[model samples]
Each structure stands twice: as C-alpha cells, then as structure tokens.
Target: MKNDERPLIACPQCDLLMREIPLPSKGAACCCRCGATLYRNLPDSLNRSLAFSISSAILFIIVNSFPLLGINLQGNANAVTLLQAVQSLWDQGMHLVSSLTFITAIFVPALEMGLMLYLLVPIRIGLVPPGVSPIMRLLQIIKPWGMVEVFMLGILVSLVKLVQDFRIIPGVALWSFVGLTVMLAAVASSFNPRDIWAHLDKDNDGKID
Candidate 1:
C-alpha cells in the first residue's frame, strides 16, 4: 500500500463504503447509490473552532490568573484559581490526582490548541504544512487528550458541591472556560485524521512507495 493510500471506510448511516480523500480540504464525497453524505469535510468548521480556541487560550490564561471559586465563612473570604486548586491538592499530598488534573485540564488543551494552530494556519494559506507526518501523529495523540467535555462535567459537579455552602459568583473567566470547552469538542470533531494524512503525501504522485 502507498503512504497516502486509504481503504474504504463504511458509513454507518447508509452502510455505504466510502474512500478516504486527502485533507486540508472541505466537503464530503457523497454516496452515489443512496445519496447519503458519508462524511462532511470539516476544515472550514475547524477554522471557526480554531479562532475560538485562540480566544479561549487567552481567557484560560486569565482564568488561571484569578480565582475560580470563592468561599466565604465567618466574615472571611478565600478565592482560588484552577492552578491554586491543584497546588492546594498537591500541598495536601494528593500528588497523583493533582498531577493527573494538571496534565489533563491544563497541559493537554494547551498542547492541542498549539498543534492545531501550527498545522492548520499554514495549510490555510495554501502552503503544505511543515513536518506533515509528525504533526499528523501529534494530532492522533492529542485527540484523546481533548477531553473538555469530561472536564466540564467535573466542573459542574464541583460547582454543585460549592453552591450548597456559599453564594457562588460566575466570572467572565468561567464563562470563557465553558465556551472553550464546547469549542474544543467542536474542533476535535471537525478534524478528519485521514485528510491530514493525505496532506503528508507531499509529492502528489498518488503512490508513496
């Protein structure tokens, strides 16, 4: 098999087998028999998501700078940012959970956003992305780490627990975080891994071998 060669992937919607096409492009090659659109090209969607990702990255930085939650009791108020929350846990010697949360919630999202921007922007400008194959691999690794939805669920649970005892005020940073979570999922879904791999076959001669 050639490097860019992709076998047919069966569409669950119509049971029509579709061939994978090259990436950094848009729209789906529909099934001629059933007229079912097997897969839609999501590069455009990814562009929108990428824009939000950049904005969210900035907001995320600000969110970390300030407090995520504030607790008031006995005429004393205490607020803590997300990093502070993790650090507090670490200070309490819950090193494992702290490390996991730090990696998943902070590092992963940042890495995903950075990698996406690095590859996508160049491709958008009609340039073959640099280091195509390795970037493709990076995308594969980052895909699982884009767990914004899971993190959001955890945040909701934490919020529920906090609201029981204190008057919780949602900040701009919090809303941005929520938006960022939703956008992250959008970006992930918008990415078509096969398409990215197609771009890696630089010579455009069909056969990589």
Candidate 2:
C-alpha cells in the first residue's frame, strides 16, 4: 500500500489520525500522541476467545437452572436458585436493588457472552456477519455494567453471615457462578474486538476496503 493510500487510524485516546501499517505477530499499535494501545494483533485470539465465551454461556445456564445455595434453618430445608434470590429481593420491596442486581448479574453478562459468540464464530470462519458495528457498540456499552465480581462478593459475604444460623450447603450452581466469572474473564482477555473491524474491511472475495 502507498503512503497516502494506506488506511487511516484515528487514535482512540487523542484523536490523532495516523496511517495504519502491518503489525508483527502478537504486536500492538499504539497511539502516537497519548501512547494508548490502539489495537493488538494477537495470534489465535478469535479461537481462544470463542472457546472461553462458549464455556461462559454454558456456565451461565447452569448457574440459573440449579440451586445456588441450599439452606437448612432449624430443621427446615430450602433451595434457592439465582432467580429465586432475585425474586426474594423483589418481594422484600428492594425494587431498585433487585433491578440493578438483575441487570448486572444476569442480563448484561448474558448479552456480553452472546454477542461475543455472535461476533467471534463468524469471523473465525472468515465470514463477516451482519450488524457488526452496532454489535460492537453494544458490547462496549454493556461491558462496564457486568458486575459479576461485585455480585459474587456480595454472595460470599451473605453466605458467611448466613452460615451462623443456616446450614449453607454449597450447590452446583454456586460453583458454576464462580466458573462463569472466571470464564468471562478469560473471554475478555482473549478476545480482541479490532479483529472484527479488520474482517469488516474484507469482502467475500478478500478485498480490503
């Protein structure tokens, strides 16, 4: 590519437009003005991220389906699923807390995992799916709202207190929640969104825009 014909890349941090160039394997492009990492060129980023995303989705289903914690108070035994706990909060009239918890704990993470899969799978196979730009925007918008770690901390704290009065039986879903958190972390580290944009420039015939 000629100097002027090379693609333009505006720095995400300082908005300084620079000419794009080929990166070495596992290299990153940095902003000239602010030194922010513009993007990375990681080998097998798509495959690694896809694997973690798939694991996260499975763990997500398991977390919601089974009992998160089994409670036995004074001889009465009860099981509480994730949704059940959220419902209990709602029944207790903590409506705002319940809604926020639901969004952060359940809704946003699910959306993140689903969007990752939708973007990664097609790009892995060398096909660009529809709605790439909007999907990428949505991922960025929801990334910070996924408060799984915070929610997990709250669960652990509550369990510590509950163990004094109730027999806290660790359930499969509890383990799965921990696993989901780990898997999501793995997905985030492995996945690079710029890969999708790189693919977006290519047509089916492998033409670059």
Q: Which residue runs does candidate 2 get wrong by more than 4 Å?
A: 71-75, 125-128, 146-168, 205-209
Q: Candidate 1, clashing residue pairs?
A: 23-195
lDDT of 2 by residue, 84-199 (tens): 76676677676876676677777778878888888888877777777777888888887675555666556546644644432334778878888888887788777787766655
Q: Estimate the overall C-alpha local distance difference test score of candidate 1.
A: 0.65
Give candidate 2's error at residue 35 in angstroms. 0.9
Q: Positional deviation of 172 in candidate 1, in angstroms?
A: 1.8
Q: What is the lDDT of residue 190 in candidate 2?
A: 78
TM-score of 2: 0.81
All candidates' TM-scores? 0.66, 0.81
lDDT of candidate 1 over 1-209, digit per residue (tens): 56457767677667876666654466566676777766676655545655766766676677677666565545677777767666756776768766766777777777877877787677656566657668778777766656765775575455446344333348866776677777777676666665554553543544332
Instruction: Tell me model 2's lDDT, rounded to 2 decimals.
Output: 0.75
